[model samples]
Target chain A: MSKVRVHNLFISLDGFSAGTYVTADEPIGDARALFGRFDGRVINGVHHVAEPITADRIFASAWGQGIGAEIMGRRKFGPQSGPWDDDDWRGWWGDAPPFRTPVVVLTHYERAPLAFDNGTVFHFLDADPATALAFARELADGGDIRLGGGPSTVRQFLAADLVDFLHLVTVPVVLGEGTSIWPGTAGLADGFDIETLTTGSGLTHQFWNRRR
Target chain B: MSKVRVHNLFISLDGFSAGTYVTADEPIGDARALFGRFDGRVINGVHHVAEPITADRIFASAWGQGIGAEIMGRRKFGPQSGPWDDDDWRGWWGDAPPFRTPVVVLTHYERAPLAFDNGTVFHFLDADPATALAFARELADGGDIRLGGGPSTVRQFLAADLVDFLHLVTVPVVLGEGTSIWPGTAGLADGFDIETLTTGSGLTHQFWNRRR
Candidate 1:
């Protein structure tokens, strides 16, 4: 059986997922100070979980403990204007992006296949939330499938009660207004259980595992 | 009299102000996300003591409200190994950086005077922390001297008990090891008192005021 998980979804105090004037060039605002929380090899270890590399290096002692597949919304894939123009704008990351394993991108517009040399293939699914979860479950192969988000997508999955676990890295600065993960969403309080709460680097990393 | 205040200084769980591998190109790791909390213009009007500006706008109407001058350490100004280079590499911001006031750089190496067309001047100070504070005090003209940090410089001033107030944005990510602001060489617990704490966007922003 496969499990669904959402990881590293960021939010601002005013319920905005991102700043309003955000563009492809400036995906994040005041990014330097906000991202300063993860600087050393520690973050790299976690990032490598999705990146493509030799199996030895992928599973090497240097890499963090656990991570399976990645799932994100199209907004995170690129700027939100045109449908997929060309393959040139793959993402912020260069040729070999951070995520190497199977990645699922949720979108309404239909697009052709986006294949990269590093085993990264952009699979665009127009199916509903249930269909996406089914595909993720199949891909998980008994492992955990991460829900990489832009807030709107995460809210949809959470509303459906499809996520099994969540790891939120909450940054301190607040935009006060933008896109938020919790607004207009409901039913999250039912089956969710907080597994652990830890504090480090002035940031609070919370983990919640779904209760059966 | 110039009052010195520390604002938006982030810390790690291990007491490292920033991780070990801070370079000139990227002074603070994960800094983008750290500052993301303040990116939105909507929240800017509410949370920020300062007003928010559009992305295209460089100068804000409330640029010099609480901030009288900008202060930073040498490493944050440029690379660590090189001697005092020319003003080519002023602080990260380009020619017309955001700060429209006297920007001070704390450095041991003295170089030729560098001036920008905009209201930014790279004033290098060789004197001790007290001298630098005095200069900023005079420059502030009764306003607060904002302590823009790189940790070590902040630690020095904090050790001398020169800081009047401190604002720490606690992001919720654990690097497991890195530079810390509070538990630095000089114990921050000794003189600083946490005056206020606000939680939003999964981050806890703490304000520490000097006991006086």
Candidate 2:
């Protein structure tokens, strides 16, 4: 059976996953500070979730953990404007990013195949959340399929009770406002069984394996 | 007169400010990532130096132009077993983590201070290089003082020479890492004018006047 895991999802105290006024200069707001300790690989994870097609698979193979495929939304791919421009704006990561698996980008905009150096491809799928998950499972081979999100996209899956495991890295600072993971939604559980909680530097890393 | 300016410091490509072995649980060894984002604070002069203190005056007035203090040092206050822990730890941050004006800590240990909460007594001085500049002037009153540091501590100040002004956020990252700053013991340049630099955060602003 295939399972979906949301790893390294960062959130502000106010519940926002990201700030509203996100420009190329300041994509994640003060959240960038939260990522100060991450290396290029983890940093690439953000872009991988947004546009999995452009990721490098050989690097994924190197992990040995075997991440089969990725899933993300349109806003994460790039600024929601017209057709794909010159491809100059390569999803934030520098020339050669880390994701090497098949990436399914959730989008309403229709576009042709976007290619990059190495063997990375950008596939724009206008499928529903279920379809995206199914496609990721198919692409995963026998490995695990992951859901990469920008709040709204993840909320869709969470609302339907799709996510199996979640790891949220709770940073100390609060943004006061931004994109939230759980908004007006109701019926949240009383408590979650914590799998692991460790403190490194100042950031707290917590993992929860849902008890279904 | 002396001034202090906090600038982003360099950290290892890894998320570590220094190395791992050092922590409150085990304060020593390879803990460089602790200070990786030191230079991030220079732009717009927005340095984020965390201080753990109990003095309200220090917290209420560590920012603005020309008025503050600088506090730092390595093993001066860290784990006991490390080679630098010659005696009881008395962090250079002073009885209140220095910086009735501003404070800068350059170290490999990631231990929170023993006391800090009421006033601005003790601040957790991270590895931001410009912190030294921001601290000196703020605490200078009109006179200049520099807190000499171990190797990593002084190297940070020398790399930017932001220390118009110099002080050691030096504690002990290692007891036997050869020479503290850089390998050679050569002194700084003659024309390297030592003047003061100053700025203010909501807390206590600082001053960094030259020492000529």
Candidate 3:
């Protein structure tokens, strides 16, 4: 079965996953500290490192494994809200996105799909978590769907019980107030088995796998 | 110097240190899951176990080391609020509380000191964080003071920058909504050097030491 997975979601000690403001200039806005310690090398297995890959890298490497499609919020696709007037803003990742798979951008506006030279393609759709998952599933081609997030998007899918596996990295910083993923998720832990690992770099990684 | 330390403070993934509504029947209320995995042996030393003590146990055993007096919120002492009319209700620990030292309970109302055979003495006073810390410092007799918490009390000391060391245990659970210790603490981690450790039992222990 193609699982719905969320990987490498960074959250502050205060449970904030993203900063309040999101502009084109500051894509992540005030939440830059959330990703300050995040090394993008984890996405591709960290094979370039001369030192032996640590457990954190191994756990984070799961982000790209067997993922054929990614379902992300419109804000994650670009810092634009409402109708997408700035059509040139492909994404923060530029023309060639690292996600070489079909990406479903959850938005209320209707826009033509943007295809990149790589396998990355962005499909804008106005749909709920289930509908968005269905769209991504068709393009996933039997592989799992990664739930790419900007906090609110992950919260939506989690609230709908669509997430099968979650990889959350808890940073030690305190962002007093920001976008939180744990809100309204009262007994979300009851449905899954959680494993926690703290790396030497002070990042606590949690893997939540849904119980069969 | 008599340090102000907090040990074994458990919080859910949502940063809720305690559940709402405390009663005699349910002392911890809806947030019992936060303390579900807590072993009392960690407070002292887990020497009773024939096997070697894990790093988590070693880290947790610091609770009893070099601690003389404790300062806690009124809620941590009992469920009753506003003037203690029930004189018979000594505390939740019955006759013998684990705190075998002077304990200053921050309250608006004053009550006669309650002395226990275990050397536990409850001193209720209407004081702020600084005043309460002064009272505890005097009682500590040069020993470090432990900041016993029910969440809000910790936040008070943290906000006042009175806390010297903090031992926060992040449990794998979501309380959804409850009493949090992270509110109003925008940069609580800035003053401290944090060390993260995850135990085999899926507990993430964060030790935040004041950077002097």
Q: How badly does each model clash, as a count of residue pairs?
A: 39, 109, 0
lDDT of 3 by residue, B1-212 (tens): 67888877888899898888899999888887887776632233321111122334434545554568999899989999987779898888877787889999999999899999989999998999999999999998887888999799999988898988888889898889899888889988988877676777788887777886
**What are the DockQ scores of the candidates, in order?**
0.01, 0.01, 0.05
Residues B1-212, model 1: lDDT tens digits: 45676655655334445666666566565443444444322213211112111111111112233466877787666666457445566656667655566767887776755677867677787778889888877766556677777787788888777887665656555566655555444466666655333333444545555665
Where is model 2 more than 4 Å wrong at Cα?
A36-64, A82-88, A117-119, A188-192, B1-212
Candidate 1 global TM-score: 0.44
Candidate 1 — which residues are off by over 4 angstroms?
Answer: A13-15, A29-67, A195-198, B1-212
B47, model 1: CA deviation in Å?
A: 42
Best by lDDT: 3
TM-score against native, each model: 0.44, 0.43, 0.50
Model 2, residue B32: C-alpha shift (Å): 37
How well does model 3 score by local distance difference test?
A: 0.79
Cα lDDT computed for each candidate against the true fold: 0.57, 0.47, 0.79
lDDT of 3 by residue, A157-178 (tens): 8999998988788998999889
Q: In model 2, how large is the Cα lDDT of residue B73?
A: 62
Give candidate 3 misplaced runs (Cα > 4 Å): A40-52, B1-212
lDDT (Cα, tens digit) per residue for candidate 2, span A86-175: 556667656664556766788776567566685445677888788888878887776565677777788887777777656565666677
